[model samples]
Structures are given as C-alpha cells and as structure tokens.
Target: MLVTGASRGVGRAVAAAFAARGDRVAIHHRDSAGLAASLRASLPGQGHAVVRADLADADAVAAMVDEAAAALGGLDVLVNNAGQAYPHPITEVSYREWQELWARTLAVNLTGPANVTWCAVRHMLARPPGSPPARVINVGSRGAYRGEPGQPAYGAAKAGLHAMGQSLAVALAPHGISVASVAPGYVQEDETNASYKVPRGPDHAAQSPFHRVARPEEIAAAILWLADPAAEWASGTVLDLNGASHLR
Candidate 1:
C-alpha cells in the first residue's frame, strides 16, 4: 500500500492503520523527510519505505510511484491523501494572488492525484493472474459540496477529484481496480496542521450535531473499509464522513 502525504494528519493515520494490518506501506511526502522517515520507523511492520516527490511535478510523481512500487514489491492499494488549501477569498486577494492560489491548489489537490493514480494503475494492471482487485481511495473534502467560501479553489479541486474518482472507477472496473473517495468535514487538526485550522471552539464544534469534529482515526477507519476486497462493489461511490454536518 502507498499513502501520499503520509507524513502527518489524516494521511499518517491511514498509513498507520494499514501497517497495523500487516501491510507494507510506502509513505510519500513532498518535503517532510523527517516526518516521513519517523513514520516509516514507527510503523508496526518492516519493509515500509519513505518516498518524497513534489506532486505538482508529473515526472517526479511517476518516479516516486515507481520507486514505491519497487520498494514495497508491488502496490495493492493507493491512498491519494495529499492536498492543499489556501484561504484566498475573492474580495481579500489581488488578481495575481487569486490566479496563483488557483493554480497551486489545483495542481496539488487535483492534478497531482490524477497523475499519481495513472502511475499506480500501471502497476496494478501488472499484478499476477487471479489477484484481487486493487483499490484506490482518495481523501476528498466535504467542502466540495458544502462550499469553501474562503477557499474557492480548494472546493473546486475537491469536487473535480470526486468526479475523477467516479470516472476512473468505471473505467478501471474491467481491469479489476476499484476507485472510490471519502469526503470528510472539519476533522480535528493535528500539530502539523494547526496553523491552517479554524480555532477550536463551540462554534466550530457546532458545525455538526455531534458537537465535535472528526478524528483522523475515524476518517482512517472509513478509508480502510473502502479498501477492503469486499468493497469492490463500492467503486465510484463517494462515502461521506461528516457526521451529519452537511447533507447533500
């Protein structure tokens, strides 16, 4: 299994869960070498590898995927959990800044995953005869449906990601590769993401009836379920993990 952005936060949790399941994990991070290495060392299993690549760079993404596949022997699952969100409200930023934010956010949150999936599927297609269908699980955001007023690009990219997963799900079914995505809302921030998070307060918790935000582990659990062999029938489905915060 390979989990992008596995250095921390939800990605870290996903990687840990898979590792605990006795799977060898490839942890991918853009620049967080220290964190990625730490995660690889702390994981429960051996053979875990740490890989780095700038997702926005297509060549780098291909190389990274190949490296991971070689290191882990092969890839049975891919978790596209890497993403970026920049708060650039239309009214608050200059036109140049707006363009910059859109390009950067889309590159990392949408195009990057698309490229990564392309590379991974190549590996999946080569699996031995009778192997179980491979799984591709993308970590999307509820903002795709609920709206990201302060970060329109992030919302748009996530919406695109969801659509892409559905399209690939259908396209890859015949090849025995399942593609699905999870859309989560307001997950509790970890140390690595504290600066980008909304301050924890009653107002923040009130976003859901549960009066709280999601834990990384909770999101990981859903992702784990989606990657199960039994979930092959669930390809193209976008599972919502928002705790009833935003119904569509």
Candidate 2:
C-alpha cells in the first residue's frame, strides 16, 4: 500500500493502521524526509519505506508512483491524503493573491491526485489478474458540501476529487479497481493542537453537537474498512464523516 502525505495528521494515522495489520506501506512526502523516515522506522512491521516527490510537479508525481511500486514490491492500494487548506476569502485577498491561492490549492489537491491515480491505475493494470481489485481511497473534505466560502478553492478541489473518483470507479470497474472518497469535517490534528492552530477553532465541539471534532484515527478506521475486498460494492461512494455537523 502507498499513502501520500503520510508524514502526519490523517495520513499518518492511515499509514499506522495499515502497518499495524502487517501490510508494508510506502509513505510519500514532498519535503518531510526526516518525518517520513522516522515514521517508517517506527512502524510495527518492516518493509515500510519513504518515497519523496512534489505532488504539484507532474514529472515528480509520475516518478514517485513508479518508485513506490518498486519499494513496496507491488501497489495494491493508494490513499490520496495529501491536501492543503487555507483561508483565501475573496473579501480579504487581492485579485493576484486570489489567483495564486486557487492555483496552488487546485494543483496540489486536484491535479496532483489525478496524476497519481492515473499512474497507479496503469501500474495496477500491468499486474496479472485473479487477485482482488486494487483500491484507491481519496481524503476529501466536508467543505465540498457544507461550503468553504473562506476557501473556495479547497472546497472546489475536494468536490472535483469526489467526482473524479466516481468517474474512475465506473471506468476502472472492469479492471477490478475500486475508487472511493471520504469527506470529513473539522478534523482535529490531535488533542494538543492549539486553538488557533486549527482552521475553524479548536472548540469545534459545537459544530457537530458532539462537543468534539473528528479524530485522525476515526477517519483511518473508516478507510481501513472501505479498503476491504468486501467493500468493492461501495466503489465510487463519497462517505460523509462529519459527525452530523451538516446533514445533506
């Protein structure tokens, strides 16, 4: 299995969950070499390795996919957890800044995953059949539905991601590859994250009526279940993990 942006946060939790189950994991990062290496070292089992590349760079992303396949022996699963979220409210930012932020967000969150998925699909298809279908899990955001007026690009990118996964799910079904996405709301980096450190406020407990925000591990567990071969029927589904923050 290969997980992009596996150095920390939700990506880290997902990587750890797979590793704990004895599946070798390839952790991808743009510049968090030390953290990636440390995560590889700390994993419960062996065969875990770190692959580095800038997702925003097309060539780098292509190479990274190949490198992950080589390092992991085979790529059966891909988790596109790499993303960026920032406040780029139209009211505050200038036109130039607005364009810059939108470009950056779409480049990383949308185009990057699209490229990675394309490469991974080709890689999986090259392998012999008879095995279970390969799986691609995208980490999206609830902002795609609830709204991200403060960060329209982020929401737009995530919405595109969900659509892309659904499109690919149908296109790849014959090839036995399942693609799905998870949309989470107000995820807390961890309990220790400073209030201001979080996008919406650390006191997001009120948002869901649960008096608490989503946890990284909770998201990981859902990813794990969705990756199971039994979950093949769930292909193209966009799961909502907002703790009822926004019902649709």
Candidate 3:
C-alpha cells in the first residue's frame, strides 16, 4: 500500500490506520523527511517504507511509485492524499500570483495524482493471477462542491480529482481495480483537537449541525472502508465525510 502526503494531517492518519491493519505501507512525503521517518518508525507493523517525491514533478511521481511498489512487493492500494493550496483570493492577489498559484495547485492536486495512479495501476496489473482486486482511494474535499472563494484553484482541482476518480473507476473495473474518493470538510490535522484555535474556529464548527469540524481519523476511517475489497460496488462514487456541512 502507498499513501501520499502521509507525513501529516489526514494523510498521516490514513498511513497509521493501514499500518495498524498489518499492511506494509509506503509513506510518501515531499519535503517532510523528518516527519516521514518518524511516522515510518512509529507504525505498529514491520516492512513499512518511506518514499519522497514532489508530486508536481511527473518524473518524481513515477519514480516514487516504482520505489514504493518494489519496497512493498507490489501495490494493493493507493491513497492520493497530497494537495497544495494558496489562499489567493482573486480580488486580493496580483495577476502573476494568480497564474502561478493556479498552476501549482492544479499540478499537485489533480495532475500529480493522475500520474501516480497511472503508474500504480501498471504495477497492480502485473500481480499474479487470482489476486485480490486493487483499490485506489483519492482524498478530495467538500470545497469542490461548496466552493473555496479564498482559493478557487484548490476547489477546481478537487472537482477535477473527483471526476478523474469516477472516470478511472469505470476504466479500471475490467482490470480488477476499484477507484473511489472521499470529500471531507474542515478536517483538523489532529483527531483529538477540539478546536481550530483560530478566529474562524466557531464559524467552521457552525458549518456542521454537529457543531464541530471533522477529525483526521474520521476521514481516515472512511478511506479505510473504501479500500476494503467489499467496497468494489462503491467504485465511481465520491463518499462525503463532511458531517453534513455542505449538503449536495
């Protein structure tokens, strides 16, 4: 199994959950070597690996996937949880910043995952006959449908990611690959944290009738379920883990 952006936040939780399940996970991080190393060491099971790659770089994404497949003895699951965001409110940012952020955000959040999934699918296809079906779960956001006025690029990228997951679910079904995505809302990096500790904490909490935002582990658990073999029927679906914050 490979979980990108596993060094922190929701990605971190996902990696931990999988590792605890006795699966050898390849933890991917862009520049968080220290955090990634610590996470790999903290995982309960053995045979876990640490992989680094800047998702924006196509070559790096390819190499990283290959390394993970080799180290883990082939990929049974792939979690695309890496993302980049720049709060460039169109009215507040310069045109140059707008263009740069748009490009960077889309590259990391959309195109990069597509490339990584493609590489992983290739490795998955090589598995011996009669093997269990492979799973590819994408970590998307409720902002894709609710909108991110402060970061339009991020919203657009996530929307594209969801669409891509659906497309791949259809395309890969014949090959025994199931694809799905989770759209989470206002997830705190830590599961135990009760507050955002920022000015908008109350506002974010109020978004959900539950009076709180999502915990990383909550999102991780949904991801874990989607990766289960029984979840094959969920392919092409985007499960909402947003606590009803943004109903669609």
Candidate 4:
C-alpha cells in the first residue's frame, strides 16, 4: 500500500494503521523527506519505505508510482491524501491570487491524484496473481458539499475528486480495480486546529452535531476499511465521514 503525504496528519495515521494491519506501506512526502523517513522508521513492519515526489510534477509522480510499486513488490492500495490549499477567497483576493490558488489547488488536489491513479492502475494490471487487490481510496473533504467560502478552489477540487472516483469506478470495474473516496468534515489537524481552537469552535462542532471535529485516526480507519477487499461493493461510492455535518 502507498499512502501519500504520510509525513503527518491523516496521511501519517493511515500509514501506521495499514502497517499495523501487516500491510507493507510506502510513505510519500514532497519536501518532508525527514519526516517521511522518521515515519517509515517508526512503522511496525519491515517492508515499509519512504518515497519523495512533488505531486504536481507529472514525471515525479510517475516515478513515485513506479518506485513505490517496486519497493512494495506490487501496488495494491493507493491513498491519495497529499494536498494543498491557498486561502484566497475570490471576493477578497486579487484576481492574480485567485488564478494562482486555483491552479495550485487543482494541480495537487485533483490532477495529481488522477495521474497517480492512472499509473497505479496500469501497474496493478500487470502485477502477478495473489498480489494485493487494486484499490484507490481518495481523501476528500466535506467542504465539497458544505462549501469552503474561504477557499473555493479547495471545495471545487474535492468535488471534482469525488466525481472522478465515481466515473473511474465504472470504467475500472471490469479490471477488478475499485475506486472510492471519503469526504471527511473538519479533521483534527494543524490545518483545522486553528478553526477548532477559535471562538468559532462551537459552531464548527455544531455542524457535525458531534461537538468536535474528527480525529486523524478516525479518517484513516475509514480509508483502511474502504481499501480492504470487503469494500469492493463500495466502489463508485463517496463515503461521508462528516458526522452528518452537511447531509446531501
């Protein structure tokens, strides 16, 4: 299994969880090579390794796919958790900023994962029998449905991610490759900690009726389950891990 952005937060937790389950993991990070190395060292298994790649770079991403698959003996599951967001809300930011934000956000959050998926699917198809099953579980955000008024590009990218999964699920069904996504609400992480620590915390919690944001481990657990063979029926489905924050 390959977990992108595994140096911290949800990605980190996902790698650990998969490793705990005896799955060999490849942890990926763009510039967090040190952290990625530490994570690989800390994982429970022996086959785990660290990979570096700028998701936005097509060549690097392709190399990552090839290298990770080779290290793990073959690719079975891919967790597309690497992402970045610029908080340049349209109404407040200059037009130039908006363009930059959109381009950056879409490239990393949407296109990067799509490119990885394309390469991973081909790799999986060429793997020997008895290798891990082909699974692509994307980490999206509830912002796609609830709307990220402060970061519209983030919302749009996540929405596009879910759509991509749905379409690919059908297209890849015959190949025994399953695709799905998880749209989680405010996760407890550095990116969201400020929001939850502010006076607005209560409001954010109220949205979920859980009185709190989700923990990284919780989201990771969901991804692990979805990546398991038992979840094949969940292909084409966007599982909402939002705690009912914004029901569709």
Candidate 5:
C-alpha cells in the first residue's frame, strides 16, 4: 500500500492502521524527515518503506508512485491524503494568490491522485485474473460540499476529487479495481486547534450532534474500512465521514 502525505495527521494514522493490520506500507513524505523516521520506528512490518517526493512536481509525483509500487512488489492500495488549505477573504485575495492556491490545491488534491490512479489502474489491468483488485481511497474534505467561505479553492479541489473518484470507479470497475473518496469534516488536529479553532462554547458544541470535531484516527478508520477487500462493491461511493454536522 502507498500512503501519500503519511508523515502526519490523518495520513499517518491511516498508515499506522494498515501496518497494524499486517499490511506492507509505503509512507510518502515531502520534507518531514523526523516524522518519517518516527513512523518507520513505529510501524510493525519490516516492509515499511519511506518515500519522499514533492507532490507538486509531476516528475516527482510519478517517481513516488513508481517507487512505491516497486517497493511493495505490486501496488494494492493508494491513499491520496496530501492536501493544502489556505484561507483568504474574497476581497483580499489577489489573482496571483488565487492562482497559486488553486494550482497547489488542485495539483496535490486532484491531479496528483489522478496521475497515481491512472498508473495503478494500468498495473491492475495487467495482473492475472482472480487477483484481489487494487483500491484507491482519496482523502477529501467536507468543504467539498459545505462551501467554506474563506477557502473556495480547497473546496473546489476536493469537489473535483470526489468527481474524479466516481469517474475512475466507473472506468476501472471492469478491470476489477475500486476507487472511492472519504470526505471528512473538521478533523481535530493540532493545526486546526491553533488556526481554525472552534470555540468551546455552548453554541459551538450545539453546532453538531456529535458535539466535537473528528479525531484523525476516526477518519483513518473510515479509510481502512473503505479500502478493505470486501468493500469492492462500495466503489465510486463518496463516503461522508462527517459527524452529520451539515446533513442535507
């Protein structure tokens, strides 16, 4: 399994979960050498490999996927979890800034995954019949549908990912491959705690029935379940991991 952006947050948790389940894990990190080392030390399997790649660079992205596939002998799963979020008021956002934000977000959250998925699909199709199908689980955000006021680019990128996952599911089904997206709500991470803090007030607690933000591991659990071999029938489904905060 190849887990991009596995150095920290939900990606790290997902990698750990798979490793705990006795699956070989290829951890992809951009620059977090310390975090990568920590993950290597923590993972149970001897097949754990750490890969570094600047996901924004096309060549690097391709190399990352290829290297991971090689390390794992064959790619069985891909978890696209690398993403960026930049919040700017519409009036204050400049064209250049918007372009940079959109490009970066789209590259990592959309195009990068699409590229990896295409490569994995080709590998799956070439495999012998009756083999377990490969799985692609995209880590999306609730903002894809909820419309974050200050982060339109992030929302748009995630929405594109959802569409891409659904399309790929249809395109790869005949080849016995599965593609799905996991859209998580406000995940309770250190960064979110520092920057996008939801006040611990009565009104805030009442905003959702769950009364708290999602833990990183909770989201990882959803990804794990979706990536399970038995979940082949659930392909193309955008499983919402939100706490029913914005139920429509």
Candidate 6:
C-alpha cells in the first residue's frame, strides 16, 4: 500500500490504520522528513518504506510509484491524500495565484493519483486474477459539493477527483480492481481548529447530524473499509463521510 502525504493529518491516520491491519506501507512525504521518520518507526511491520517526491511533478510521481511498487514487491493499494488549498476571495486572488492554486491542487489532488492508478492497474492486470485486486481510495473533500466560498480551485479539483474515481471504478472493475472516493467534512485537524473556536449559536451542534466535526481516525476507518477485499463488488461508490452536515 502507498499512502501519499503520510506525514500528518488524515493521511497519517490512514497509514496507521493500514499498518495496524498488518499491511506493508509505503509512506510518501513532501519535506516532512522528521515526521515521516517517526511514522515509519511507529508502524508495526518491518517492510514499511518512506518515499519522498513532489506529487505535482509528473515524472516524479511516476518514478515514486514505480519505486514504491518495487519496494513493496507489488502494488496492492493507493491512497491519494496529498493536497493543497489556497483560501482567498476571487476579488483578492491574483491571476498568478489562481494559476498556481489550480496547478498545484489539480496535480496532487487529481493528476498525480490518476497517474498512480494507471500504473497500479497496469501492474494488477499483468498478474493472475485470483489474487486480491488493487484498490485505489481517493481522499476528497465535502467542499467539493458544498462549495467553499474562497477556495474555488480546491473544490473544483476535488470535484474532478470524485468524478474520476466513479468512472475508474467501472472501467477497472473487469480487471478486478476497485476504486472509490471518500469525501470528508470538517475534519478536525489543525487547519480546521480555528473554525471550531467560532460559536454557531445554540443549534451549532445540531447543524450536523453527527453533532461534531470528524476525527481523522473516523475518516481513516472509512478508507480502510472501502479498501477491504469484502468491498470487491463495490465500485463507483462515493462514500460521503460528511455526517449529513450539508443537508441543512
């Protein structure tokens, strides 16, 4: 299994979840060498490998996937969790910033994973069908549907990823591969900690059906479940882990 952005946040949790299940993991990080080292040491298995590459670079992405596959002996799962967001109102956003935002976000959130999936699917198709099929679990955002006012690029990229995952699920089904997207809402990470401090009046807790923001582990469990072999027949599924927050 290859987990991009494994240094922190939801990616870190997902990596730990897979490790707990005895899966050999390839932890991909971008400049978080210290955090990556700590996570690699924390994993239960000895085969866990740490990979570093700029996901926005196509060559680097392809090379990273190839190297990770070699290190893991074969590719079984891919969790595309690396992402970037620039929250700025359209009026204040510059042309250069907009281009940079879209380029970086789409590269990591969409194209990088698509390239990795292409490589994984090719590898899976070459092997005999009886073995466990390769799984690609894309980490998306509820912002894709709810629409973050200031982060248009992030929302658009993630929306594209959701569509891509749905289409790939059907396209890869015949080859015994499964693809799914997990769209999470208000994940309680450092990035969202400030938002939590703001009071939403009396009905704030009741706004979301779940009554609170999601813990990273909760989202990790969803990813793990979707990647399970038992979900082999489940394809083109977008498991919205939003707790019905968007309903209101």
Top TM-score hit: 1
Model 3 segments more than 4 A misplaced: 191-200
Per-residue lDDT of 1-248 in model 6, one digit per residue for the tens? 99998888788899999999999999998788888888899899789999988877878877888888889888888898888776766888889887877777778778877887786676667665566768989999888988978878789888999999999988888777899998887666644224423433436446587687778899999999989999876678878887788742
Overall local distance difference test of candidate 6: 0.82
TM-score-wise, the better of 1 and 5 is 1
Q: What is the C-alpha lDDT of each candidate?
A: 0.93, 0.90, 0.91, 0.88, 0.82, 0.82
The digit string of per-residue lDDT tens for model 5 on 1-248 reads 88888987788889999999999998988888778888878899798889888877888877877888778877878898988777765778888887887787778777877877776666656656676668989998888989977978789889999999999899888867899998887776544134434434555446579898778899999899888998999999998887898764
Question: Per-residue alpha-carbon lDDT of model 1 for 107-183, expressed as tens digits?
Answer: 99999999999999999999898876699999999999999999999999999999999999999999989999999
Worst 10 residues of 1 by lDDT: 192-201
For candidate 4, the C-alpha RMSD (Å) to the true structure equals 2.4
TM-scores, one per candidate: 0.97, 0.95, 0.96, 0.94, 0.91, 0.90
Best by lDDT: 1
Which pairs, if any, clash in model 3? none
**Segments of candidate 6 deviating more than 4 angstroms:** 190-207
Q: Per-residue alpha-carbon lDDT of model 2 for 1-248, expressed as tens digits?
A: 99999987889899999999888999998887887888888899888889988889999999999999998777899999999877899999999999999999999999999999999887888877675569999999999998899999999999999999999999999988999999998777743233325565646778888878888899999999889989999999999999999899
Candidate 3 per-residue lDDT over residues 1-248, each given as its tens digit: 99999988888999999988888999999988988998998999789999999999999999999999999899989999999778999999999999999999999999999999999999999999887789999999999999999999999999999999999999999999999999998876453223322333788999999999888889999999999889899999999998888898
- Residue 6 alpha-carbon offset, candidate 4, angstroms: 0.9
For each predicted model, how many residue pairs clash, with residues at least 3 apart or on different chains? 0, 2, 0, 0, 0, 0
> Rank by lDDT, descending?
1, 3, 2, 4, 6, 5
Worst 10 residues of 2 by lDDT: 190-199
